[model samples]
Every structure is written in structure tokens, then in C-alpha cells.
Target: MVEDYRTHPNLAKIKIVLVETSHPGNIGAVARAMKNMGLSQLVLVNPKEFPSQVASVRASGAADVLNDAQVVASLDDAIADCQVVVGASARMRKVSWPQLDVRQTAQLAMETVSADAQAQVAILFGREDSGLSNAEMDKCHYLAHIPTNPTYSSLNIAAAVQVFVYEFLMATDIKSVHQAEGYRHQLASAEQLEGFYDHLYQALQDIAFLDPSKNARFMRRMRRLFNRSQLDVKEIDILRGILTAAQRQSNQLKTLTQDRD
Candidate 1:
């Protein structure tokens, strides 16, 4: 039996995240789209306008989902608890992160949630005007791309979310996908990753490997790499310990060099 998306232990963990959305009506439409399927979780990051009359009117019968939506100040805050993050963008970038279509992404999300009930997956949609900035997308594990007509190929935020949400529900309904293979350990959350990345950046700078602050592209690639690895909590701790040791040794060497000079 298909459990309700709102209450399904694992399905409920999936969240739809929006970044810098401008139009309140679009938000309402998106809420309506989400409710069309069984999905209910919605997170808005720095929305221009929320609780607007325009949005409430557009939400129609989906007022419940709209009312329950979580609003946050930043993308990091919105997805702090999410273990898996997918950014849905119409543009294609053959860069660090692997690109997958909506169907594939939906399948991946389902598999991850099935593996661990407590694990959360966040599907992110960018702003209406410029889409997600590079810095914003740097935080994603995969780029969920939608192939559209070459002629006037832009999609409204609500429409895009609708397509992704529909595919997500279809992925769940078609067949019974078991929890990810060997899904024993819990994956690291976005918050933990942010902290680990900070530690790693400090360690690299300590040894003069490369200033992570100056090397935005390199750090993005690094994020993509570790994000792809799906590092668990223990793995993060191990890496942090290694980096701490390296930093200490690097500091000691620097002090000796200064003494010699």
C-alpha cells in the first residue's frame, strides 16, 4: 500500500526548497503543484514576499501546504538538516557535479530516503530571474536538469516544481524501490558538511596548498567530490582529525622556519 506522502515515514523527509523566489503567486502555484501529488514539505529561502494575498489566493485548495511552508534566511539554513541536495536548473553545466534528468533524480531521491527513514533529501529550485548562482549550486550534490525546447526554453518556477514533483511521485508509484544498497550508515547533513569544508579549507591554507578562499572553483570541485562520496558522520570525523593533525604539523614547521630566519 502506498502511504500518504505527508506521513510516509521516509517520503515525509523529502523537502522541496525554493531560493529567492520573487512572485508570491508562483509560490502559491507551487504549493498547489506539490499538493497535487502527495508531497507536502516545502521550504522557502529568502522569498521576496510570503503570506501575501496573491499567494494565498493562488494556493486555492492547497492552503494547508502553503501555510505549513518553512521560510528561512539562507539556502544553508533551509537545507541544514538535509543529507542529499539536488538543484533543479534548466541550464546545463558540464562541470564538477554529475547532471541527471528529473526522472533519474527522483529515483535517486527515492532510493536514498528508502534506505534511511531519518535521512532527508532536498530538491532545490532557483530564482525566477537568474536561476541559482554558482555559489548556491556549489552546495548541491547533483544538478537536476530538465531538457526543454531550444526555442524559448524557460520554465516558470511553479511549472518546473510541478514537473519535478510529478516525476517524484511517479518514481515512487511505479515499483517498490528498496533502501539504497548497503544503506547502513546515515549520511552527513548539509550543516556538518559546511563545518567539515571550513576545517578542510583552514588545513589547506595552513600548509599553503592553496587558499581555498581564493580558489572558489577548486573548492566547488572539492564540494562536488565529497558530496558525491556521500560521506557519513564517522567519515567526516575521521577526515577532520586528519586535517587537524596536518594543520598542527604545518604550524610547527612554520614556527621553525621563522626561528631559523
Candidate 2:
């Protein structure tokens, strides 16, 4: 009874994010894979190599995908407007996160777009050697892992993307869910979240809760918590206001200390 996702209007809202990619050919291959699955949105974050003829040769006839691809400086920029973000990683970290198999991840991503007409989904694939880092994974609501031979389980970034994209198309059920009229307000974007993080860090520094020189583990954990909460625009504003007030108070306390000294 469900309509084909290939023809679904929301299908266009899905975005593929590649972070710190090394090889140009993988970029081209990813483009080809996306095109094969009727996906067009492609974002590259700090790729080591791009605009190479090797990529063009690999892309074959799917050069249009490469031509239209967005090159960004950071993952935050790439996924700024997306309502949902999923990161693909095979490595397990010390801290546990909500994990999903490729199939469920695809289903969840498709269902998000189906629920809200304005919703955009981002599936993040990381660098060839390391995949996503702990800091990067904190930005994702869920971690998707592709099941492979545990003995030898590495998958190429482009091939992994194709597998997930294919799952998305097959998992989607377009007929059951009706798109909502609109979201009450747009969800806080990754860009906005980055701004919030900067503000929070400054506030923490002002109060001496965090040292500027040392890279702390707590920050990553905090990011994981906030990302899972899915804060909206209003919530972000309130938090920013709180941080500003805290900064002001910290400044006044510092002034008193300096005078006493």
C-alpha cells in the first residue's frame, strides 16, 4: 500500500555528509552511489582531496552529483539545517551511545522526513582510516553500524554509504504517514548548536569551571547529552541567555578579586 520512496517528495530532504575524506575517488564513488539510490544532496567536510580528475574518472556518468556537491569546512556547517543526524562508525568507544543497525538507522531517517515536511536528515560518514571521532559522534543522536564479518569488518566509505542509502529506499513506507502542516518552529540547527557550545565554553572559562589550555573529556560527554535532547530554537535562546548572565556575574567576581589583590 505504501508509495515508492523514489517518488516521495521528502526523499529529496535526505543529505549525505562525508567528513575528512582522504581519497577523491571515494567522493566520486559516493556520488555515484547516491545517484543510484535517487539521492542528490551531498556535502563534503574538509576532504583531504577533491576536484581531482581521478574522482571525475571514477564518477563515470554521475559527474552531475560531483558538480553539485557542497564543500564545507566542518561537519557542523554541512548538517546545520538538518533535523536529524546519524553517524556511521564501526569502532566502539568507552562511552556507550544509542546504537542502531544499518536497517533501523535507515528506517528512522526516512520516518523523520515522512513525519515533517520540513525535516531534513543527515547521514554522516567519516574519514577512511579512523571513521568518526568521539567528539564527532557526540554530535549524532544515534550511531549506525553496518554488520560485517567481525574477523574482517572494514567497509569502504562509498560502499558503506551505498548500503545505507539502499536500505533507506527499501525501508521507507510513504503511504502510512502523512506529512505535518509545519513544525512549530525550526529545530535548532547544528550551526546554532556550535554557537551555543562556544558561548558555553566562554562562560565556563569566565567562572574557572574549565581551563582553556587543557582538552577535557567532560565537554564531549556534555555534547552527547545535549545532542540527544534535540533542543529547539526557543530552548537554545534560553540557554544562551543563561550563559550570558553567568558571564556577567563571573566578570564582576573577577573584578572584586583583582581589587582585593
Candidate 3:
């Protein structure tokens, strides 16, 4: 039964979350959209209206999704196990945050989800009027923006969910085929990658290559490059080992110089 359910090429991780939704109709519509894309997990955090007849009617045949949907008190509780969180935002903000276009965000989600079986991925949609607040967006590791007309960028909540979920389903399908064919690359888990980054950063600091006084500007760029590359588990492990060896060599050299002096 598990194999049968997972045989679909588009199958991805769980926990699609909607936050602060004002309209039950939109919630139902969003559930329908998720089912269309073969996604089943749905979470609602502090919705304005739920269990409404309007939502059930709008869900049409996807009423099962609504019936099984989890209602949470807070966003943190909803996404606690998710390693990768993608927040959809229509408007740009003054403060800087990591952003990914829908396509790229979908790819990252697939990579992260497939890397570890236990890893959860979340796609967060905000309320209709304002979209995600800065605090809510900040909770996400990455921000996702859909490409739309500049003249009129107003997308309904259900519509936005449809666009993102479509991209996600497509990307997951393509990646799954490539993976089955042994043609796709793998990526390290966030925990593994973070450990590698820490070792690399420490090695660079020891060599004076990374200036401590500069406030990690260069380190951030290196992080971006790695994220774009999507290094696999083996790749990250190998790199971390190399960094460790280099650091050891540097320490040995320092000891030799001190003894000679």
C-alpha cells in the first residue's frame, strides 16, 4: 500500500499550511487546488472562518481534505518539524530576506524533502488582504514570489496557492523521474550542510582568509553559492573532511614555526 501510494512521480513531502485565512471559501478552494496537484497535507493556523458550509461546498469532491485538515493554534506549531519553509509574498519589503522564485523554491523543496525521509517541507500562504506579515515571513527560511503582471499583481489566496502547488508538483515529478533513472544529483540535508559550513568558516577564520571584523559578508556569499549548488550528502561530507584536514595542517605548521623560533 505504501509503495502504491508513493509510486506517483509527483509525490512530495507533507504539511501544506495556510495561515490566517479570512474566508472559508478560499480554504476550500485551496484544498481543491492541493488535491488537483496530488498534495494531501493541509494545515490551517488561526483561520477566521472554518467548518463553514460554504467551504465544504467549494471543496466539491475534495471534502476529505477539509475533514482531515489539522487546525493549529500557531504557525510555529504547524511547522515545527519542517526543515524548509517557503512563504509566498506578493509585495517586496525594505528589509532584506532570502527569496526564491516559485520554480527555484519548488526545486529546493523537492531536494530538501527527498534528502531525508523524516524532513518536512511547508508552503505558507498568508491572509488575503496583506499577504504574509514580516514576522511571519521571517519564520520562513526562504521567501517565494510568483511572477505576475506588474500592473496588477493582486492574486487571490486560492489562486496563489494554485500557482505554487502546480510548480511544486511539476518539479517533484521531474526530479523523481531523473532520480529513478540515476541521472539526478542528490543534496545534503540542512544539518549536514550547516556542519560543513561551520567547519569551512572556522578554517577560513584560522587562516585569516575570512576577516572577523567584516561581519560575515563574505561568508554569506559563500552560503548562497552552496545553496545554489545544492551539494549532496557525500559531496558535503567530503568537503568538510577536506576542510578539517587543511585546518589540521595549518595548526601543525604553526606549531613547527613556534618550535623553530
Scanning candidate 2 in windows of ten residues, the lowest lDDT window is: 174-183
Candidate 1: tens digits of C-alpha lDDT, residues 21-129:
9999999999999999878899999999998899999999999999999999999999999889999987886565778889988888877777666789999998899
Off by more than 4 A, model 3:
1-6, 9-12, 174-261
The number of the candidate with the highest TM-score is: 1
Q: What is the lDDT of residue 142 in candidate 2?
A: 81
User: What tens-digit string does per-residue lDDT give for candidate 2 at 96-149?
Assistant: 777889888777777677665677889999989988987788778788878889
Per-residue error at 85 for model 3, in Å?
0.4
Q: Give Cα distance to truth, residue 223, candidate 2, Å.
A: 0.7
Q: In model 3, what are the clashing residue pairs, if there are any?
A: none
Models ranked on lDDT: 1, 2, 3
Stronger candidate by TM-score (1 vs 2): 1
**Tens digits of per-residue lDDT for model 3 on 239-259?**
888888888999999999999
Indicate the residue-level lDDT of 181 in model 1. Answer: 45
Q: TM-score of each candidate?
A: 0.92, 0.83, 0.66
Task: Give the TM-score comparing model 3 with the true structure, all chains together.
Answer: 0.66
| lDDT of the candidates, in the order given | 0.86, 0.82, 0.75
